[model samples]
Every structure is written in C-alpha cells, then in structure tokens.
Target: MVNIDGHTILTGVLAHPIRHSKSPLMHNNSFAKLHLNYVYLAFDALKNQFSDAVRAIRALDMRGINVSMPYKQAIMPYMDHLDETAKLAHAVNTVVNDHGVLTGYTTDGIGFVNSLLNRGIGIKGKNVIIVGAGGAATPISMQTAEEQPKQLLIFNRKNGHSFRNAERNAKLINKSHPGLAKVFDLNDRAKLKAALHDCDIFCDATSVGFGKLKDQSVVTDPSWFHPDMVVYDTVYAPLETCLMDVAKKAHVKHVYNGLGMLLEQGAASFKLWTGKRMPVDYIRKLLLKSK
Candidate 1:
C-alpha cells in the first residue's frame, strides 16, 4: 500500500464473489506508476454480511474501497455521508475512509457519460435503450436521464419484486427529469424490437459477460442493432462480449466495453481517497498497452 508520513495507505474490495476481480490489478498498476505505497486487496462477503464487511473495512484503517454488484446498495446505510451523485442514484460504488468516517460516492454514471462523450457520442435528445435494471443500471439510467435523452427505455427479464424496484427507480429518475424514462419487459419481443429500432444507443448493464459467465450472451439477434446504433456494454472481461460481437458484425457505428468506465471510476475513487487528481491519461494508456 502507498504510504505517506501521516496517512497509512490501504485499499479494499466489496463484491460477493470477488476472487476474480481485476480491480486490484488496475489500481495497483496505477499506484505503481504514480509511485504510491498503497495496496488494494479483495474481500468477498455474502448479502447479509455486507454491513459487517463495511465495519471490518473501517477497522482495517483502509484509505478507500470499491463496491461491486450486490453490495453497492447494501453499503449505503453504513456510509456517514453520500456525495451528490450517490444520493441521486441511491447507490454507492466508491467509499473513502478518513479516521473511521466513511463518505460514499458513485462514479459509474459519470465515468460512462465521460467515456461516451469522449468518443463524441452525444446523449442529448438521443433515444436510448438500457438492458437490465440491477445496481449498475440505476446510475446509468439516472445519469442518462439527466442528460436529457429524447427517450430512455429500461428492459428487465424477470417480473418479480426486482422488476418493481426497477420501476420505482425509473420513476425517481423521470421525476427529476420529467418525461424521459420508462420501464418495459424484455420478454415482450415486439416491444423490445420496436425500442431497438428507435434507439440510437443501446447499453447492456447486466452481468451476462464476465468471469465464469463470460461465454453467456445477452442479446441473441444482430439485426436488432443498426449501423447507426452505438452499442455499449459494461462488461470488460473477455474484452469483447457476444453482444458487442453482434454489433461489430452488423457494422454498427460504434461499440465500447467497460474499460474506460472502470478506469474513470477508479480514478474518481482514487481522488476521493487521496484528495489528489489522478493521471487519467496515463491510466488509459496503460489499459491500451495491455490490449
């Protein structure tokens, strides 16, 4: 771990099944490049153990931690304060601990938005369709809605209380940015097809591509994506997901994976931890060099 005279540098992980996380690689590489003495390690915790895990993190005197998957929302209640983005999305992906006080923040949405804009894909007045309504979906949808998209449609496969939770989130997003959000069932093929036809950007926010599930596919049809469509999948492992492959074969205008988002969010969290602006371009170059 990177160490300063007074600050004992440390890092942590917050994912249910975190054995396969690459965040340690990414962050540690950046730390080495910057000549910091900080070390990041992974911690796996079950759903019910999330609160306990946060307590443990506090006791560890860690500088910061990244929250992933199921624990993003669960860790919210344990935080001392929420940043504006975290409060807006009702989720926290980054946390900074300063002498036992933890402040929560969400960098996922801003990372994604920055990545899209960096690629010159403007969200203003564009129709967007987002697949999945899980932890990642909330921030992406909320931030996209705030960007004033012409329309935003969220599709989820299941129809249980989780679906209702998604609808509630959609309402929260739309309420803040009136008349821009709606939720639908992905099982309704006709509706999904129609949405795809009208969408300028399609995002996959599900865990259909990563780790042991990397071989799984999200969307089955290439025809659903047009040459004008920009497909973005928040899945970096395997580099190219099946949905992205479909987009590429369909000659889509643009396709991006989650690497940029990961980099940006990690930089954001690093800033929160150290109160220092990270060399983002260097991190980006590192990622590219790895490819």
Candidate 2:
C-alpha cells in the first residue's frame, strides 16, 4: 500500500458504477514502482454529484482525475479548458489540475491507436470499420482518421442520438481528411457485411458485450468476419467478449478485448499528471499476472 501524508498528491477516476474499474490498480502500482508520492483511487460519482466531484479536484488540491462513462461528456463543461483532442471528440476522459486550472484531454483515441500499434497492427493504408458513435467510438474513429486509414466507416443505430453522432463524426473526419470517412446505419446488414469483408480492422465500440448484455454482440453473424481482419472490442469486463468470441469462432487470427486500450489510456493519463513515462512493460506484466 502507498503511504498517504500531507505531501502526497492525490489522483483518481470519477464515474458512476466505478467500483469495477481497474484504474486504481494500474495507476497506484505504477506510482509505487516509480516511488512517487502519489495515490490513485476510484470514486463513484452519481449524476447529481458530478459538479461537486469536479470542485473537489481543486478544493482538495488533487493532481487530476480520469472521467468515464456518464461523466465523460458531462464533466467537460466543468473543465477550464479542453485540449484539441478533447474538443475534437467532444469528450473528456482525463483531466489534469494545475493548481486550480483544470485542463481536459481525450486519451481514449490515442490509447486505442497506440494499443493497435503496440500489437503490430498498423492502421495506415488500411480500411477500418467501427461500430457505434458514442464516446469510445467517436475518439477511436477520429484517431483512426488521423492515422490516414484508406477508408473509415462508422456505423450506429438509425434512430438514436448515436446515429446523428455517427453522421456528424463522419462529417468532421471528412472535413479534415477529405474522402477518408463515411457513415452508415448499423442495421443495414448488407452494407455491414460488405464493409466487414473488406476492412482490415473492425472495432466494436459499443456496450453490447458487457454488463447485462455480456452475451450480446452487435454482429451476430460470424460469417461477416474474415481471417485477415483484426477484431477489437471496447469491452473488457468479461475478458472474452461476445464480439471476440464471434471473431474467434470465425477463425479470425487477431481478436482482442478492451484491456489494452484501458492500460494504454491510463498510461497516457499518468504521463499527463506525472510528467514521466509509465513502466508499461512492468505494468503490463503485473496486470496480466493479476488477471
């Protein structure tokens, strides 16, 4: 356990249903290994408690906090400033408090891209298909566009705000990288099948594979997947998500859950807060061992 004293700097993650999060383990262990007088914790911030949670960052003189789920977009308004990526994604997953000036950033996209790169999967010159248009999907797609993928396809439900977000995100990506991105309704099975067949990377950024929907998958048909394509799901709770299982059933060689993204994003946040690169290799081994 890390020693807590008057000089210790505090950091944490804020989210509803936050008890299941592994962030504290990843960060606190990293701080311990680096011999830094920092401690990380997880706080369950309900809807009404969010504003006060943000205030506590300043009032308590804490270093920062990682935002997740319902708070990602909600906490942005409380931030003094949003970095370019945070503004681009319209979501803030990591916030650093310099004295009382809180600056927000979106490290999810960077983490997603870096996770793929670390796994020897390059996004450049490849066709990518991503499902959903919420927080995880938006940043992942935006960052994938930054990598100059040959074709970027985003799919979401046709009726909800997510569908509108899908169209909007595609437009934003196209504005900066012309002719690189396109949006489609996820229910269009024919198009989804065709895109999956042709894409090099297929990412499920939806919540279908975890929580109460652990057995559910957005792509029910395993035949849509190809052996040459990499499948990634932004759900790590069950380890082997339904999408991952589907991909494996289809004999896809590289199928992964969201654990890598979680680790990489936490590392990015740690860097922003501590100004030191995390011992990723050691942490990776530690996480795996814990798992």
Which candidate leads the pack in TM-score? Answer: 2
Best by lDDT: 2
lDDT score at residue 72, model 1, on the 0-100 scale:
84
Error of 1 at 209 (Å): 2.0
Off by over 4 Å in 2: none
The CA lDDT of each predicted structure is: 0.82, 0.90
lDDT of 1 by residue, 1-291 (tens): 355455547787789788766677778777777788788889888878876788887787888899998778888989998998888788899998888889999989888888898788889999999887777888888888888889999888756445875787788976777767888987788898878888899999888887767877667788877899889999887789988888898899899998878877787888777666777787677777674
lDDT tens digits by residue: candidate 2, 147-205? 98999999898976778888889999999999888888888889999888788999999
Instruction: Give TM-scores for every candidate, taking all chains together and pairing residue i with residue i.
Output: 0.92, 0.97
Once fitted onto the true fold, the runs of candidate 1 whose alpha carbons sit more than 4 angstroms away are 1-8, 158-161
Error of 2 at 158 (Å): 1.2
Clash count of each predicted structure: 5, 0
For candidate 2, give the lDDT of residue 283: 86
